[model samples]
Target chain A: MDTLNKIINWFTDGSSNKLSYHYFSRKFTPMAFIGPALLVMAILLVFPLLFSFKLSFQQWHMIEQASPFWIGLDNYFELLANKQFWNSFGLQLLFVVVAVSFELLIGLLVAVLLNREFPGNKIIRALLLLPIFILPVVSGLTFRFMYNPQYGAINYFLKLIGFNSIAWLSHPETAFAAIIIQDIWRMWPFMFMILFAGLSSLPEEPYEAAIIDGASRWRTFLHITLPLLKPTIMTAIILRTVDALKAFSEIFVMTSGGPGNATTLLSVHIYKSAFKFWELGYSAASSYMLVFIAMIFTVLLVRNMFSE
Target chain B: MHKFKSWSRWKKGLFFLTVFIILFVELFPIFMVVTTSFKPKLQIWTSKSPFELFRPTFKNYLQVFKDRNFAKYIKNSLIIASITTFIALFLGSLAAYGFARFKFRGNFLLSMGVLASRMIPPITLSVPIFILISEWKLLDTYFSMILAHISFSLPYVIWLLLPFFKGIPASYEEAAMLDGCSRQRVFFSIFLPLVAPGLVVAAIFTFMLSWNDFLYALVLTSSRAKTAPLAVSEFIGQFAPEWGMMTAAGTVFLIPVFIFALGLQKYIIHGLAFGGDK
Candidate 1:
């Protein structure tokens, strides 16, 4: 009975001094708590990553294969030499930079304007979030329809301003710009909300002191508000950067990586290579390239933003 | 503060003008969708201004409802989303408690692992996951998509819920432990009730993630478990695309998310801010 009590006590309270039981519960309790999550992740994430690593080195015609054969460095070399793959990679970088910068810029400007209390502020804030909440696929299609050259609203508006009715999605440069516009519209509010939260939480004493010193609004904003808002801005930039890099559905729907691969971002490129071309090995290699690039970006952002 | 009060009439007009312009840019496309969905067939193709007011009808919406595939897609979406949310919240809360309460070796590594899992782009996982699911012969089933979604959402749930669990006082659990309750019992009885709001936040966020996902659903489920997004995308691909029908389907899809975003604006904001944390 005493021994049993000691066992139960050890298990329950970590009170017993027995090396084995102490070690067991010490390790097992936390495992008991976190093990299911780890297991789920292993099956769903880690295994897939390792499996893809192996597949990326192998040659397999997805439909014609009873077995995949290992091909050493062939896929990687092919992807390196492939102009289409490199173009897609460069385009993804460009897309991420342009879209995220515009979103941050517009979001900051709007957030600064809307930071102060005004009538119907709550209503305006709520309405601003609709684009963020709408389905990406829906947003893509809606924009696709609206960009129609002959009957679209955008062209109609452009004609009202005396500009020619441009084929927004038919030209490569305009098609890419059109996709960026849609992305900015959908994602800018995310930046706005974060900045607004930061703005509201800023210390009032600094602004009051600036006012007493007779600082101009621009000077006060430049010195005080901008410095204080750095962390939130960095956070917004990092989050938007990550999201823009993985953007797929909108580009998939709006242009399908057209007109002529102008907007073929990495995600869309990977999807097409894997599913459409059935080049499993090549697709896996390209995806890892994306994963590598994204990880580097995230790590850099985190280190920079959180180091202080 | 003084600037706001001492603003001239022109300044006030500019402020309101900026606000109105922003509002217009935000809502005009949405309003177009709503109006176009209600337009009859002939008016949809007209060269007249897309914004010009016309007689609205329910024909497109009725057609969407009458289609059998639309109903199946909604059912599949609901089933996949609910199951994913349930499983993610359940497992995620438990893991969150572990991270929150226990300061053990490798704790930092494990928590970091949870966050790092999110960094792996979903596209990177799609090929291997698709192959594995097909091999298991589980493709196009609720189980496959639900598992995929749970995998996608669990890391987020664990991260979001961890802070909430940490916010609960440890003394309550310690007192419960003194009274001879098991840890599981204490968690369920004492700590869970205190973190009810956290659970609600996590649930809604998880639901939204699963509901909004298109890539996983596109690859994993073809017809049997087709989601609304996939259905709508496919709808756009048909020859002689009906703009009215597409808009109607889009509007129907937008309703639930719109209500959730507006009604739970605070929680959404709180959750997003939480997500932005390191």
Candidate 2:
């Protein structure tokens, strides 16, 4: 019995035959607890990621080859000089900046407005989450229908207001803008909820001090609320930026990266290259580039989140 | 003093009016989708205002229901989402407990790795996952989706639940241990009950992530395992979309999620604030 227990302990805790029951349990328990999650992570995430990295260096078409052959630096070089690749990268950057900015600005404003007590406040707050919870496909389709120049509600509204009906998703610039608008509509509620939580939990002392100082509302907002709310706002910005950079399904549905690759964000670009065009190696490389760019922002986000 | 009171009352009125407008704008698309789903096809084309009332009909919804593929997609979505949620919660809470309770070797690094996985772009993995799933001949199967979803949701599950576990007092587990229970037994009998609300929050998030998934389901599944999101996207075909049917499908997608959001608003807020899944 003692030897059997020792073996179990040795396997679990790296301790030898001289193991105490308490020590074995204390040191090895976490392994038993975390083992399944680690297994799942390794199998599903780590393996595919490593495989993708391997494929990024290989040359093969999924349809035309039995196995990929090593072709060092070819995919990377091709992407570097590819105008379409560069265009998509630039568009992704623009998308992230515009979408995250609008979401943060509007979200904070709504949070400030809805911060005070009012009738139906809870109901309105709850209703706001509907947009956040709607499936991206639904939002994309609904917006696509609404943006339809012929019989769409948006164009109809423009006509009612005596303005010319603009093709929201037809032109390159407008297509890009339409995606941003759809993203903001889908995501701003997320920002609003986070900021509202931040606003409500704020310590009262600063506000009282600002009030006693007879500061104007704008001054108090600038000095007191803004400073106090920076962490929450930063969190929202980091999350929104990371997500906006990867915006795919909605853009996939809404414009299909079209009116001539105008709305082709990085993810959509990779999708088309991989599935539609069968440029698997090139697609993998593009995805890695995206991962690299996103991780830079993600590192900042993680550091900011833990800074407190 | 009377003038000042009147002025404040006017300000309150203005505030409420602004709040009402914000609420309307927020709900505008949803309301249009729901209303349009109920409006007949003729009424939909004729209605000048998006907000106009029409004689409601279930024809669009009936058409959606009549499609056999739509029902299969809904069933697939429910099965995948629920299974994924169950698996994620089971595995994630265990890892979270490990982090919360033990000072193991490489704990910080491992926790950071999990969080980092949360940040890794799923699109980056989609290509390889597609190839690998096909290699294993698991494409268009439930297991493939369940595994794929577990990859994404586990990180979020562990991250969201870790704080909840840390918030739990250790004394309860210790007390159970003193009563001759094993550590695992203590976790299940004593600690699990205490963190039930946290578990629910984690489950809701996992379900939402799995349910709202499109990119993965779009790439991974083809015929046998298509999800509702994929089905809804299918409504926009090669040519013009069927708007009435699309709105009807969109409404079906909206109802359950909206109900869940309303019912679990407080928990959802807490989860989101903790940096849960988008």
Global Cα RMSD, each model: 3.4, 3.5
Q: What tens-digit string does per-residue lDDT give for candidate 2 at B1-278?
A: 01223447778788778878888877888987898899888877666778777788888888887963588889999999999999899889988999999887899889888878888888898899999999999999999999888888999899998877888789988777666666666677788899999899889889989998999898899899989889888877878577788899888888778778888889988788776322
Worst 10-residue lDDT window for candidate 2 chain B reads B1-10
For model 1, residues A64-133, the per-residue Cα lDDT tens digits are 8877899988999999999999999999999999999999999999999998777788888988988998
* lDDT value, residue B186 of candidate 1: 68
The whole-model lDDT of each prediction reads 0.85, 0.85
Candidate 1 structure quality by residue, lDDT tens digits, B174-218: 897677665666677888899988899999888888988899989
Worst ten-residue run, lDDT, model 2 chain A? Answer: A8-17
Over A1-308, each residue of candidate 2 has an lDDT whose tens digit, in order, gives 35633443444543323355457766677777787789889999999999989889998798888889999999999999999999999999989998889999999999998887666779889998899888888898899988888778888878988999989998999889999999999899999999999899899888788778999989989998999999889888888887787679989999999999999989999999999988898899999999998789778877886788
Candidate 2 docking DockQ: 0.55
Q: Which residues of candidate 1, in runs, are more than 4 Å off? A: A1-25, B1-5
**Residue B117 CA error for candidate 2 (Å)?**
0.2
Top-DockQ structure, candidate number: 1
* Residue pair clashes in candidate 2: none
Per-candidate TM-score, first chain only? 0.92, 0.93
lDDT of model 2, residue B165: 86
